[model samples]
Target: MDNEILLRLYSIYQKELYLYLYSLCGERQQAEDLLHETFLKALLALPGGHTNMRAWLYMVARNLFYNQRKKKSREILMGEQEYLSEKQTDKDLLEKILEEEKRRELYRAIRKLEQKKQEIILMQYFSGMSQKEIAAVLHITPENVRVLAYRAKKELKKNMEEFQKKSAGREDTK
Candidate 1:
């Protein structure tokens, strides 16, 4: 692709792609960097005639994220237990998003999901990707994406109901 076409593609997909990366890494600056790197790599050797350009772009961005994560994993010097516990400290960041009540509750529920389920839910629902697109980006079959999405939605509903019941019980005591 020429510079003009590539820039157009960047403009079209950058926001969602940045969100995808942000959802993976949870750092705005890192996500921005990854988004830029994704397009830079695409500019270098993008294969021609892709049926789903969005999926291709996401795949590239996701691959870049994993690569950066892998390198950081190698560099971690703490013991396994300490390193794992350190990850839990990011929960403070979660508490800061309390301005939106329902969204906060939804995110709390989503946090309880397994990692892949969280990713599937974010990609399919939040990012507006179709099952086929998510499958392509994740390197899974579309059927698998559909099945996971079904299970995730069911789990989210259950969790949200539980939250509602708890909130109601709390109100009764007030």
Candidate 2:
């Protein structure tokens, strides 16, 4: 696109794009950096023009966020031994402890879901994709998407109930 069009698009969608990236990264700085990087890449590659600029921008940002996450995951796995050997005695210990507890609980609940069900739920709710859009993204029919969403919600509710029961049991023991 021309400079004017690019500038307009940037002004219009920057906040929404940043919000989307923030949701993906769960970090404001990282999201802002990614948003800047996304627009830079878009300017470089798509300067000529784009038929679907909004979708194009989203795809670029999403890909970059996921790529960073994948790299971080690999690095963490490679450093697992070192990480395990480190002692946690710093002032950050309390914050880390609470974060770990919450993460564990969230992970346990997520793990209870089937992979496909989890994907559907995350895409629909977390990614804010419409049912039709989600179906298109997943290469499934809209009817299937609806069915999956319903089933996933039911499964999540069941999992949460189980988690609550276990938590109650632990509290009783305490």
Candidate 3:
């Protein structure tokens, strides 16, 4: 892309890229650093001309975020003391409790899925990737992506039904 076009793309997409990174890293400073790295890499990789510049930028940013996350995970596994303990104020503690509860519910729902189904569901739904995009990322065909998503949804529905059935049984017992 030309310098002007690249500049425009940077201006338009910088915030979005940072937000995406923030979601991944859950820290503003780290997200800003990642965003800067993404842009720098994009600048180095930019050819004089290319189609789908926006998509290319986003893809680069996403890959950078993923790579950083993987590195952080490895570091944590290697006994890095990354977790910080803090005494939350009342409002913060309340929010944290609510968030923990919601996370528990989400994890329970996800655990109901088979492994492959969970992967497909997370890529398509949580990641907001199109079937084609997911297929590309997963090294599968678009048709297969669609089929997997359908099967995953069906499995989730069945699991939800079973959970409801068990819940009702408990209520009757009570």
Candidate 4:
């Protein structure tokens, strides 16, 4: 691929890849540096069978993160995140709080999953990548990706159910 093609690819995938790297490294500056390194590697070494540019880019970013982490032994854990919306009435406020709690519980459960399962869930659900694309990025079979997704979802369901039950018991006491 030429530099022009690489630039287009970078432009298209830059933000998504940056967020992905940030989620992995949990540092904005490190994520940005990794992103630059990812694109630079892509420019220098375009692999064969690279019809899936998005998947290829993700794979490159993930590899760069691994390499950098190995050198530094620094994996920053992300703090709790609360997604906020515009101002709202009391009813909307309650609903928003409930929604935020659910999101937090879900992410907490996702963090409990095995690394591969977590990767599959995030790439497919959060990042909007297709099963085939995820397979390409993870270097696994599409069927494997599908199976892992199913298992991950099942685990997440179980976790949420258990969490809700505990929450209900606590509320009952109050």
Best prediction by TM-score: 4
Give lDDT per model, in order: 0.82, 0.70, 0.66, 0.87
Model 4 Cα lDDT, one tens digit per residue, 1-174: 687888898889998888888877778888899999999989889895768889888999998888888898865575456656666788988988888888888878988899899889988876889999999988899999999999999999999999999999999999
Q: Compose the digit string of candidate 2's lDDT tens values, residues 74-170.
A: 4211101113225667656776765666566665565567755665676677567677765654567889989988987887778778777987899
lDDT of 3 by residue, 53-113 (tens): 5556656766886688777674211111233248668788777766664555454665667
Q: What TM-score would every model get versus the actual structure?
A: 0.80, 0.59, 0.53, 0.85
Ranking by TM-score: 4, 1, 2, 3
Cα deviation at 159, candidate 2, in Å, is 2.1
lDDT of 1 at 18: 88
**Clash pairs of candidate 2?**
1-49
- Model 4 segments beyond 4 Å from truth? 79-93
TM-score of 1: 0.80
Residue 146 in candidate 2, Cα distance off native in Å: 3.6
Ranking by lDDT: 4, 1, 2, 3
Segments in model 3 whose C-alpha atoms lie over 4 Å from true places:
47-49, 75-104, 107-129, 137-139, 151-174
